[model samples]
Target: MKTLKGIKTHPLVQRLQWVFNPVKYMETNVQEDRDIFKTTVTGKGGLIFVNSPEGIQELLTHDTKEFSAPGSVNGILRPLLGDQSVILLDGDRHKRQRKLLMPPFHGERMRNYGELIQKITRSAAAKWKPGQAFIARNTMQEITLAVILQAVFGIYEGSRYDELKQLITSLLAVTDSPVSSSLLFFTALQKDWGAWSPWGRFLRIRQKVDKLLFAEIEERRQNWDENRTDILSLMMAARDEDGQPMTDEELRDELLTLLFAGHETTATAMAWALYWVYREPKVYEKLIQELETLPENADPMTIFRLPYLTAVCNEALRIYPVGMLTFPRVVKEPTEFMGYQLEAGGVLVGCIYLLHHREDLYPEPKQFKPERFLERKFSPYEFCPFGAGVRQCIGMALAQFEMKLALAQILRDYDLTLLEKTPVKPARRGVTLSPVGGIKMMMNGKRTPSKSVAVPATV
Candidate 1:
């Protein structure tokens, strides 16, 4: 097994552009070890995977200034999300766009959603009974969609909420199965025609969502409601540093991105947390004991302070990261990563999946242990499931808070277990990772997060 360190750019490395599904290919036998040192994926083919903590730091923290988002992502997502989307921008433009979008995801701002989180989760959990199987992802998605809708629109029910939910749900239906697709970010595919022709379905769904959003924008504009507390209101009221208001198109793009990014990833994280803790009784017991210490009526701050719960969330993210890769970065100038002399315009990806599972950084990386996060500090590069740098996920804190609270609330009540005894591996679904068949789990009953810690899942 040759390490990528001394290896020259092999012929396979040069042909990486021809590779359509790089992530699925990541595990296949290409890199001699498959643990590290996969081929560089740029036109110049000098990409290197130094899964070391040090390498993670150099690339994500130190070298980030040089790397621009690969043109690949800009090509795919921009069409769906629009050129003004936060995902599409780079450099200063990215910074400004992020700033405008940051308020909704801020810690203080997110704190207000805690009640809604518990309420929504509880509401969804009410319908289930023991012996009846439920898809964990669907439960999480329904709750997440409702919670995000309330937070984004201030309309918890009524025709508006229903209409918006239906439209958004319909749009998401295409990719909601969460199956891994190899074609997520292939830049050249923009020129390639689909064999079956997907544009018609894509356009039809796009029109449905757009019509709903544009209609909402128009309604809000007509009435000009200042009392609305949802994200839409914030966007309506928001003006840039120069006091220039965002256009309706800008509003649609940002709102749509938030709805898409904010909801699904959090739901997936919640589902994985449930699975890992249930599968490992010891871990579940520890989490219960720690959670039990909190007051029955503990506020959002107390839940946020629970160290073990935070660790659990961190570990779940580590084991099966919802997002396997970071926003791509292109080589700005000739550089050497891990002594592989790479030329300018080379492609580099922040291979988050590989880094999280690195044995040196995480001893027994495959094990489900939350204590690793507590024992030592991992460089931002090593532990960045949400990514690092100024371009980090805006909803990182919000997602963590939501996951911790949501899981604590659920675990405190319902006794749940995985429907199967075997483990399910992760694959990229749309832009996030989802379990195959959406994780079948049986809920024993509900327990409020404040009372008994780890209640026994009903036998």
Candidate 2:
């Protein structure tokens, strides 16, 4: 098989580095070939990595025409999201699944989520006390998990919701360590020895989650409420071209997909945003100043449109994209990509990490400067935090809304200070790159009441 500019590292070393220190792996490879290259990182050999905007645009624009974005290429995710999940569907099925899932996260349907997001953020923030240090990521995770559960299941507070939340959190915690994360990569290690084993614990937690999910689904089926706006209710009402409702198994898989994808990635993104905002005093001051211009009780949409807040979120995503690569797009026929020649069956991934760090596109790329977003406008391909085109994140709008509203609420409602001055590096959190230590911080105290912003009545 032909190759792009190849990194010289041994395949075994590359694979281990990719799993253990993915940021280091990508940084080293980009130094060798900034635009495109090949690696054994995907558990498959000869996968091409393309980071340039031109390559990403071509790959995404012509997706399904010149190249096929097959979901089987995303098998790394299938162990978590099942065979029937939208993330694992291909061809017409992928398109149809995306359509069915898109409505709840778009336009007016998304606006309905704003007040709920702020309520969750405020409630979570209320739990923090002055002078007490805590992991910001955990705090953000708590807020995001609640938001997603409400949006996905429409269950605000209940024993089942609490159980589902606890089990999912525990299951995901298994991936916090390199050893446990490797279990997802090595299929043989997935065998269950007992509840004490890593895979065994994962299976057990997953089973409980499954039971809770099925019970919820069955109850909703027996007493379906058409007026409910949650994603689950929306999906329950939707039918495909064949005029068929999703099967219980299909609903379970899709619900799991939305739950996992919706909460985890957004939580990580918000955590990084909080870290950057506090770490850079100027950024923090400017952000608070912008946020304060609005009434303390500003609506979610009002906060979402704040210029500096948007830039802060954009910079955070650019600095360390949660998912480092787009789902692999395969070469449909013999063709040239960017400047390289490729044959049919070749796999391509838009290397989001490298693209964001391109020195030409972002001068002094490592620096967290929100002003870069303000100074210049970038094309969708150029500034894609979420991957572009056919397989772009279905929840892009909701994620952005959550990040902006939650950050705005936290900044206006309470004061926080980073406990560690040293830079926090990104580490592998399952498939996403998250802050290494979850961004530790101390809550100073609640901000004094001021005319700059008014406290929300609901809080």
TM-score per candidate: 0.87, 0.95
Residues 328-391, candidate 2, lDDT per residue (tens digit)? 8889998877667787888889999999999999999999999999999989888888888878
Error of 1 at 395 (Å): 0.9
Enumerate residue pairs that collide in model 2.
296-454
Query: How much lDDT does candidate 2 score?
Result: 0.84
Off by over 4 Å in 2: 1-5, 449-459
TM-score of 2: 0.95
Candidate 1 residue-wise lDDT, 327-436, digit = tens: 66676886666656655775556778777877778889889999987898776888988987656788787788778888888877677867765677765567667776
lDDT for 353 (candidate 1): 78
